[model samples]
Target chain A: MSKGPFKLERAGLLQLLQALKTQGYLTLGPTVREGAIVYDELHRLEDLPIGYTDHQEGGSYRLEQRGDGAMFGYNVGPHSWKRFMHPPILRLFRARQANGDLEFESEGEAAPKYAFIGVRACELQAIRVQDRVFLGGPYQDPHYKARREQVFIVAVNCTQAGHTCFCASVESGPRAQTGFDLALTEVVDGEHSYFVGEVGSEAGARLLDRVAHRAAQEAEWNQALALVDRAARQMRHLDTQGLKERLYQSLEHPRWQVVANRCLSCGNCTQVCPTCFCTSVEDHTDLAGQVAERTRRWDSCFTADFSYLHGGSVRVSTLARYRQWLTHKLASWQDQFGLLGCVGCGRCITWCPVGIDLTEEVAAMNDVQTGRFAPKEAGGAHV
Target chain B: MVSLPSPIVVDPMRPRPFRVARVMRETADVVTLELEAQTGPPLRFQPGQFTMLYVFGVGEVPISISGDPQKPERLVHTIRKVGAVTEALCNLRKGAVVGVRGPFGSHWPLEQARGHDVVMVAGGIGLPPLRPAIYHLLHHRQDYGRVYLLYGARTPRDLLFPEELKRWQYTLSHAPGATPVRVTVDRAEGDWDGAVGLVTSLIAPLTIDPSRTTALMVGPEVMMRFTIAELRKRGIPEENLYLSMERNMKCAVGFCGHCQLGPHFVCRDGPVLAFPQVRDWMTRKEV
Candidate 1:
């Protein structure tokens, strides 16, 4: 069928992997290593973590074995797709003198073709957010553009939700809506195990022909829809209506001080976040001071030097730093980028050293007694 | 599986080479470098715009383009030796090569204030960025009404471009609708003959109608705040006043996120912004 809801046997995953490698692609998928589900090169079907699942919450993550042995049954992990698209450290250029004049050689043309498998819907939304930042902006980042152009995406519909998952509340996920070549819903019941594959693009339909698949029946389509509905109901929720205004009014609230006391400013949250794209430029010279290279690395807003002006750093107080990070993530980002920075994947909550749950913190600031914040007029009003 | 042309192929981070044609010492710690592009078209800049000057082996710093806008061949940057990158910029010789990016950020709105009186205020090293606007007003002297300059420095020795200031004062004296150059020193020494007080003192005695005037201010944050308060008292609306703000600008574009103030990035939205746009942000500390 042109628009297929096709059924593939659970064991046909090996055929799909081989088809990808038959073409010129490096297939990357989820696997268990070092206690977390991380993406790595997949040379064979056994590379996937079958029968394994995970439980994630604020400052905690644990692996658990499932009875049915599903290959994809978990939510997002601490590592995001940006680690490959927009690298942590990118060399912008190299400069050297030529006949008493300087010339800059750009190092942004070469990139490997990658096929990402088992991507969650929220993670795909996060990639879209980064595309808006790095590619949709006025000046495009060539390095990110090069790495992003050749990647194929295979999205996985959630069959389960983590304790920290809130993608439904943010209008990002539980199922993939767009920006994918192919999407899959893995269904396993008492005596049945199979995957319902849906083609999102021409490439996907063409690739589906290579794998062993048949047209899905009406029952199988309804089963996939029920799985999506159940996953949506299982996740946590946050009321994001009027959140920007609430954060603006609570900038000076005393709860900031309470949170600052617990924040270590270790920047682990930004490092793990899929949508945070701030960076710092560093310059280094050769030992003889002949060649100079400029590289950009990941940077965090919680650091003291992030807002340094002439005299000193603006966010010197911990209260100011924490407020900057949280407000930028939840509020001012809308004003700047016309979208919320958080995709609601909850990596920040799961990776924080003290388990600082932003949802709870935002709820605390919204409450009357704990936050001690008073609402302003209907429109935005300055204090 | 996926093969498509890149959505965007432009790299905005690369810096072009510009050789230092001349260097003039303005003060003990400050120097102005006149540069010429070694290749490509000449860089175009307007008043209140700045460029990121990168030393060969050192880092880069954002310095205002202080030259006349019409002369695109020659670029001028007046820098003070404050930090590592700035110190490296100050140590450059005549033929030294440096990387140049941008003429970034918003420019002063001089064309909008054509029929109204214009006031220029400067303090310490802030005068360089405002000098281009002054040049524009004088070149098109018939397009505007009366013009006045109010400048203040820490002391007589700390003043920059003394010869140019004297020439401008002379021109203003000879021109029609002449006004005295209101220069002040915070603490005068060595037989100083100018007014001795903060720059705010000069605003009280101006005869121009406040309702039909535009003010362009560039100085320390405290000084700009006090000057704006005095202008507000005289019935000048916040929209009529423009000021320049400074932060650690790593990229002249908006990508780096270092120079963000609230929702706006100073490097992209402005180093120069209208007073009403930044009034609430200026009031909040550590914003």
Candidate 2:
């Protein structure tokens, strides 16, 4: 009667799609294909990642299958809530010259009510970061502010760890504390599997009432808690306290040189980064060549031209630019936005050509911060 | 006779290829264009902001406000033909059309500098940005403190606003709210009786109450740097000093980081920056 938690049998849960579809719900979840885990238009429950999990680091990425058909078994991905909310590129305004007057037209808003099927804790935090970035900021981005309000989130507890994940280190993860419409913990037994789904919103409670599910018993809740606890214990973690300040002080640290030697400057890390939102503007005239239209494109900090000015670029060297980017994401981000830029996702390390792990980088910096490593003379150190 | 006050509801101005309204070849490289904002609201800009002047295939460049802010009807851009867009803009004839986006970037602190004695120091073609300030000073002389101008051009002919400068000196002198003028040329030809040497050299002769004065400066960053250094030696506070900067600005909005200087966007946060606000970034090349 408390509406505390409910249980759905594993086989019955796979039919969760048919139930949602009949109820006019759009189920969006992860589908693995082409060696990468991507979000796509999913219709059937079969499209979900049942026995798949992924390994991600700075620049290295891999997707693999598990022994079981356990659904919802992956970490944060290249796509985040930003895509549905902000949309990578949106037309802001158009100028029309009419009757010798310029008119600034506000673009039409996107219309979609989304259901994020496999949301994780780190992503929940990432959503809040973007919320603060797009809405909480003084500008109040109209597009992001609107789309975020229409979504219903289904948070899944991570019972498996990814190589690049360290939300446990940053006090962000392993469990969904808040910011979800529904939270689920998948518990598998030898031949019998069930899910403990807790309704976090009235919208979720109303939706669940339509499905056939048993009220979770006290024992079932405890088992769900145990499953979540095990996942937390398995987390590959990182410590985030004062990490910003420590990184800021290490601008010339040899770690940058080591990272640059391996960095291809391919810009994969930022492309997959949930928090990187810088953009560039472009102007194009129609095929008729009568009118010109200006559009904005997503931009990355790794590009040297990104910082170019009248005289020259501020960051002239590759080493300095790389240091600026890494330090900004880990250190200066807090100074600019009052939050840690990293979400503990290991896409940077995993996708990196040379396996330049952020964990190792931070560990080296931590050691250097505490005087554990001998400072090298100029041009004397790299990795 | 008096003029009616200008409309301020301000429609979003549109860019039209004004058949080069009339190009006055000011100097070797600098030329001024008079364009009418087509079917768009009249263009309005402050002393220090800029407009993106676009030539068909040539590209766009940020040119400063070289017209009177009070006269928001017609748009005036004084450009130095240094790059592709500048060359294209210069090549346009009395009727060549082009696109324009702006009156963008933060304007000079005209209202803020109203009651304070204003010292204007400009170098090379940097004088365009200060053109609006000079116009404002001449228009509302009573509202401001004593006005002064220090101008320096690369050569005798490179100087701009020639006709206006002559009147601003002769016709506008002894008129209410007028400022003293000090013009200089780095290298002069015949009939150049103005002060010689750097623009900074002329500052020594002008007496300014640093405490009550605001220095409006525009020019090459180096010229502004040396002039500001000399002013600082005069014990001028950084708060009262200002500089209008330029970069290859593609988008005037804050979205594009092209015109960014450290934490601030030159288009939005400034084309005008107080010395103290940009002191750190100015140490690097971008600023």
Highest lDDT scorer: 1
DockQ, every prediction:
0.48, 0.13
Q: Top model by TM-score, which number? A: 1
Rate residue A286 of model 1 by lDDT.
90
Residue range A1-383, candidate 2, lDDT tens digits: 24788897755555665655665556677887687777775686678776777866555666777666777767766666656765767665555544433344556555566777778888887777776555553335555555677677778888877877787787677788888877888886533456898877777776677667888999999988887777677756576767876775565577777877877776777776777666665666566554456555667667777766555666666676666667666765575567877777666767666777777877777777533323322112221
Chain A TM-score values, per prediction: 0.93, 0.89
lDDT of 1: 0.84
Span of 10 residues, lowest total lDDT, candidate 1 chain B: B1-10
Tens digit per residue, CA lDDT, model 2, B105-136: 67778888867778889888788888888888
RMSD of each: 3.2, 7.2
By summed lDDT, which 10 consecutive residues of candidate 2 chain B come out lowest? B1-10
